[model samples]
Target: MEPKREFFPKVKKTVMPRPYFATEKDVLGHRGTAAAVDAAIYGSNWYLDKEQGLIEIYDAGAAISFFNLLPRKDKYEKEGLYLRLKIAYRTTENANVNLRNFSGNHVTLPNSLTGAMYDDPQTYWWVTDDLTLNINSIFSGEKLWIQRVDWEWMSKEIIYEDELFAKNTILYRSLEEVQKLYSEKELTDDDVKDFLRDKIKNDDWFAKKCLVMLREEQLMGEKLVKLFEDSGLEL
Candidate 1:
């Protein structure tokens, strides 16, 4: 008798919708047992008020902390896996900190007391490696009270909206310059194609913009599409 083989495989992914908070004990207790800890000072500059649920930083120059994101290969492989940090408290006057990762990808936290999201263009973590995240204060006066850290997979609609905004910004700037140059003469189809060709050839970021223009059926959109297709450029 032959062994039975299943036609389909069942696979599920676990996602965390709410923010994950790490306490003082959690960090201090699991410091050496887990991955390597570069620097985590408790009393000198970094203080944790368990009562108020806040991690306070005072005049600490680049105070660092490590976080271990449990193995989640499926979640990491998905698109728009944005890392978010909930800033509970921050000084109103020039108080901010930089959230740096193991890969050196960092984003400046907003001065205001709000949640900061990391829009990293590069891959943050790998499937086989331990996901270690770090945080630091750049300036001496920069004080921050971090509440918790979390991550979420952004929806496709939100991603599309951001792309739309970028496309519109580029289109507006290009049109402003074109209008000034062709104020006296009527803008012809050839003029539009030439402008687009120059943008596509010179600007590296214009390829995305060209796709947006074609989707919106803007002027010379067809011609621009044809030009890219003829040149064997994948848009």
Candidate 2:
């Protein structure tokens, strides 16, 4: 006999809107003194080359501040937001830069000479806060040059399989089946607990199946697992 294949709901993804850019005018201030460098050499200082659109740093413990750059909290309270930096920089030695919000939540930028975009691994919780970019140079002569900064919302909707199932026709049938099972008796707290336990178990099973199907696509699968864990569903 042939084995029956499991069918799962089709996952839907709505692409997020384009990212918003922050211009040089948005820069508010700096923590350390900005000095001019006549030669290619640098010291324990920072330089803002407005003409070249770069914020150059030569040592640790220096920061560049920017105005609060995100929308109101209510705007993305449910979906969450992200901060990203578009930097074209080179370092004499290994360096790290921290992108921090007013609330002090931050993400680090590891050493990279090639120009590329870097996203904050943490979600932007405080949408209405100023931002800062702190530089950390590993060596005395290490240098860094920051080119640009931008931010955006999460790229896709975060929905769990159980949440989707709750809106499906199968959920209605399941509820009706439970109702029929208790038709003759008044539902009690114990009965409700039992029902919820069964429902959760069923939802967990469905989520696991969905995860298995998504496993090959690692990013999607990891996202699904995070959603499942957040929703209190077992893997």
Candidate 3:
């Protein structure tokens, strides 16, 4: 008897939707990461497209960090615009983060200015989450019309060293796990640290990675002291 052929299951991608949006101008402050994104999204271009919106950046290994956005408002913000535009990628896009870079439509957002993208409400996006594993990698698809939001993201210097570093070890988890652990309920500092510390002892690689994270500016002054205090580790 012949076996039945089945299609691959939809892959759940790890996407961080909370991002600070700025006109292609304000984001210029992060020239280094911005350039890398530009290269990944637009090949080798001396200038960013007027319609492009520089989204987020992860400066960990300086490996991959950037977003390409298409514009919607009447005028696009350039390098010298005294304009303030905030935006957020709405996560309520159907079932999951739709893949496929085909932002050529206009969508309405709640508060922030409206924008255009290469997406349609009726059609299912072709790009699957499997392509972008959410490990601070380059995302070069769908110029989205993200709505501006008024939220302060951690300083760009934050590096998110922990998030990136954790991937190599057993601590790595899909966004679903993150959502379950923290999103659904509250976790006390001690409880959180205790849980993770226990896992650390079980996973040697995870423990080693934590040490590296500490070395990367994570240990110093109060930060160093706090690590021990939080983990209930003496000295």
Candidate 4:
């Protein structure tokens, strides 16, 4: 039998009507289009600045990606929003396919945005890795967000199959990959101070990125902890 053609689920992008307090000029050219599309899907006007940070809209959240840790890292960056996602297909005749099979059981990738799946339904929760999300890639006023990753990337073969790999639950993105997306330049002096003073103080999510920014900026030791002081918290 001939192999079946691959199919992928898709979302659409279309020109949005002029948003209130927003114009093509307000959003950075191509980014305006992205924001418009995102707004159409998410039901809120969204945009990003030059440094890839969120300007915010009515309590909307930022878009963060642990890009380097994504399954097909090279593909995502090269293709922009175009993701060629593949599902773990198992046919009874072919049990040795790429992904392990779970015959007579139900297994679905519950929250995977990139479609990483497994055969066993019992292996539900994905363990985490050290790869942190690029917190500054958030956008709201001028640019649309790239996708964000709030969960961890795990490998069952490493943990369940053998003792060859470390018994850790997560995988980490390389330093170079982290810098490319969440560059030091993304966090400005004011942005850093603001994040350290407010966002980090209030939410634990922002803390890791804040520490990365502080180290990147060379705000070492006391200088680092001192920034936290004004936020009315300790590092």
Candidate 5:
């Protein structure tokens, strides 16, 4: 006997109505999990575009972190400019964090002098729970825009070191410090440690790679902010 084909509804493009930010109250109303969201959304993809504007949610993070990390400059703060965030969404249980490129339409900045990314309504995600996610680039300027946010990310140093050293750590070498065994030859751990130390020290290329990783992490942070905003609560 042949099985019947299941019918599925066509996916539609979501439209964000009057409110752009989501508060914790919305989540309480909808009964959602913040942990799952933090893990899946912000912990994943985020980044910037080549055109000097933020791409998806992740891109927004990268841009903000980049701006924040740069030396204080006058023009970036004084210039009259605004950011347009293009948000896409889905309500299905199978829905994942997938922030696409900006729609090219920018959200106007609040009337004020010395604009900061974190100050813009478009860049912030406020939830009914009173939890707000602020996105800001550490640096400023159109020419230096392409530099990835991960380079300036503070947490990257520890996170990367932990992941890279996970298997070779002292804790994993046997909880007992079994080096007491006479049969064991010279420790091979020194070589691995030395190699990693040198890579972080002498190799300029390794430094660049670290920068990319930091920017990617920043991107993830932005996505989480977007998810909270899209949750449909007051921001």
Candidate 6:
């Protein structure tokens, strides 16, 4: 087996729209367009970021090669949407491709101006490494997302597949890949303190809540117990 290359951060550059879906006619006029794009797989309005050029939609058939994971069935009984996305990156002065299959299962699209329009289904659940692929080349990279239905919805429980692969490789998060791309910056005591402070300051609502919980527990003289509890958590 070839030595697996560690994933590097995906470099992003803003660009003008490629004019793929510039008009309603482009979506409705073309024959086989809906099927090609898998419109039925995800509702028409399920993808709301087209106006911002933040997303690009393509037919599922046009993206078969990018689907590194097992393909979901065609039927869906759930209420939410699903989709496949191609995320592109630029590194080494060359654009690289990445694949992500997004089954919009129980995912909500953010309507706020500052919020992202599309949410990855994998974010809520664990994803296997095989579902992610990095393609190095020119012509811009694309992160492909494939959305389809499955059998787990009837139970209302999230599906967790132990053996997951995208593009024939195990899926890894950007954080996991960061270690290989950047040399670890050994931190001094002062640096560690500074980093912790910065992280606490910039943390999101949920993160801040956790911090507050920790502080509250410590203030109640249960710091040692809390520490022990946290220490026992599975990675």
Best by TM-score: 2
Error at 50, model 6, angstroms: 34
- Score every model by TM-score: 0.36, 0.39, 0.17, 0.18, 0.15, 0.19
Global lDDT scores for all candidate models: 0.48, 0.51, 0.35, 0.34, 0.32, 0.34
Model 1 ranges with Cα > 4 A deviation: 1-44, 61-66, 69-89, 101-103, 113-136, 154-159, 162-235
TM-score of 5: 0.15
lDDT of 6 by residue, 103-155 (tens): 32322122222222233445234433333222221223322222321212222
Q: Write the per-residue lDDT of candidate 2 for residues 1-235, one digit (tens) a residue.
A: 9899988789688899889774533322211112222222223477778687676777566655544333332443433323332333455446665545334556555677765555443443433244455554445666677665554434233456678866542221355654565468777999998986777677988667766777657656567667677668654
Please provide, for model 1 over 9-124, each residue's C-alpha lDDT reduced to its tens digit, 9 standing for 90 to 100: 77778987888565433232111222222224333566676676666666544334444432232442334333322223354357666755534566566776553433343433
Give per-model CA RMSD: 20.2, 23.4, 23.0, 25.5, 26.4, 23.0
What is the per-residue lDDT of model 4 for residues 1-235, given as tens digits with 9 covering 90 to 100? 9799877789578988877752222211111112111222233333444353322222233322222323332223421222222222112221222211112222222323222333232323221232121122211222222332222222223346575475665455565864576454655799877766897689887888867777864655456556787569744
Error of 5 at 227 (Å): 16
Candidate 5 segments exceeding 4 Å error: 1-187, 223-235
Q: lDDT score of model 5? A: 0.32
lDDT of 4 at 152: 21
Residues 92-201 of candidate 3 have per-residue lDDT tens digits of 22212322222222233322224332223221212221111122222243122222222111111223557776554223336674455445556699988899989898
Q: In model 4, what is the error at residue 99, expressed in angstroms?
A: 9.7
Error (Å) of candidate 5 at residue 90 is: 85
In order of listing, the candidates' clash counts read 0, 0, 11, 12, 31, 25
Q: What's the CA error at residue 25 for candidate 4, in Å?
A: 40
Q: Which stretches of candidate 6 lie over 4 Å from their true place?
A: 1-61, 66-186, 213-235
lDDT of 4: 0.34
